[model samples]
Target: MSRLATLIDEGNRPVVTAEFPSIDGGGLAAVEKAADELRPFVDAVNATDNPAAHAHASNTSIAIAMSQFGLEPIMQVVCRDKNRIAMQADIIGASLFGIQNIACLTGDDVTAGDEPEARRVFDLDSTQLVKVASGLAEGHYLSGRAIKQPPALFVGAVENPFAPPLDYRVMRALKKAEAGARFLQLQIGYYPERLENFVAGCVEHGVTRTTALIPTVVLTKSAKALSFMDESVPGISIPAEMIARVAGAGDKDAIAEESYQLTLELSRHALSLPGVSGIHLTDFRHDGSLERLVRDLRIGPAFAPDPVASASGTTSV
Candidate 1:
């Protein structure tokens, strides 16, 4: 069994979840390769789509592939480009196909995705999406309709900790939780203090348990990519010094090694934080390097907190 399965079975124990990029961005074959690389320690796989992948909703192949690999799947369904009917159908189809975990997202704008010409259908935002999933779990449809059996899915939602007014993010998470979000994943983790603050904010909102996603950057700190990051990905800051550090490495392999090492260091920092239920390893489409990073670090679920340490009441970022 994978560490995730053991974590789940161990009853509320912290877990180490990894996100698997879907073949929709590259191809199914590429996804398979990434999966094979991460299979060693990857507990649960969250399959996401390309910015323009709303049209490929019919391509549920990733879920099937995950099952074939004996990996638990947390399928994400975005609502920006799908109407309620299509959303409902997809939800039911996913449940029928044995997808147990679902992440409801109010997807980004069409312009934000790869498909600019595609019209969006925001008939239901994340809040409504959560309600829909909860309703399905209760053996009912969103329209006051009933079903033969409720789907048994672990509903999840995402939050951006760096977003303005952190309180608003916490409030949104609370709404998701009220709407039946069983797990919460954050998108900001470049700094250890930021992660701790995010978790503390979650706890303050009465969230006793939620999965904290630690974002791992895989690209080398080259000048070209650093320039691209500044121009294209807003709110994504890669310091020049960090880039210079990577660029100053002995060679390309050394650069990759250092980047992965930084990721592992961040992982270790996140593991030390309290209320950090788990770490989500994100490769960000970096040539299957996450596999090597996990193996080298021997990454796994967080062990039980030491009572003696708790008595000392230690705290850090």
Candidate 2:
């Protein structure tokens, strides 16, 4: 089993995941640096394939690079560009290459990307993709055809609690869980109180016990970036106080420091919540901040709290 799967299956420990951009050539240097620096602190690295439908290196290639450096990779499979046949083939290919974890996403609309005129093939939504993955794991295809060797994978889905109709978000999560998602990585979270309430709702609906809920921790470097995310990003909600805190910072370095500190505080608060299996860290535009945070968390016991105790004093998976 992969280290992340083991961590989730065995329970007690909280898995730490960091996102790495899928790029090549000179851009790969930063990814390698992050993988090397975060090797000891992070449980797995998530590779994105041009998240906003922009152009970038393939996620599978990035996963290969991560595997080369002895790092576990969680491949993000977006349904925006591929059809069912292609996606199933990629799943088998990933398994053949020893990649076990998959994060299923419906993907942003083509209009949201650089190429608005590009044709999209959303043959399946995220929930349907989870079902496809589950079928693959069970030695069958979505068409009810049987496979000789089924892929052994840990399926994951994404959720956005900050999205409108909060009640619908929890129901969507439950639907994903029923569709065969074993874990859920939530959208960018800046409001801990809102996240806690969402997790509480998940517990109430029995989704927490069945699916591992992992909230995202996005690290912003400046007030400008925070404002942009609030305005441009579709489902993300950055607290007003957080933006004001960044705006009130003394200088660039101070803004970065404040952002990092706030991220750490949010991480700690997320860890304290019930039914939270882990935290996913995504640093936009500034990868060094993530590296610095991971290093600091590993340097001393002060920052590295016990996951078991922090997670509602229970070791249940």
Q: What would the TM-scores of all predictions be?
A: 0.80, 0.89
**How good is model 2 by TM-score?**
0.89
lDDT of 1 by residue, 46-115 (tens): 7774433334423346766676677677777778767888877777887787777777877667776567
Clashes of 2: 0
Residue-level lDDT for 158 in candidate 1: 72
lDDT of 2 by residue, 155-250 (tens): 988999878887688899999999988899999977777888899999999998779998888777888988888888777778788899988988
Angstrom error at residue 285, model 1: 6.3
Which residue pairs show collisions in model 1?
Answer: none
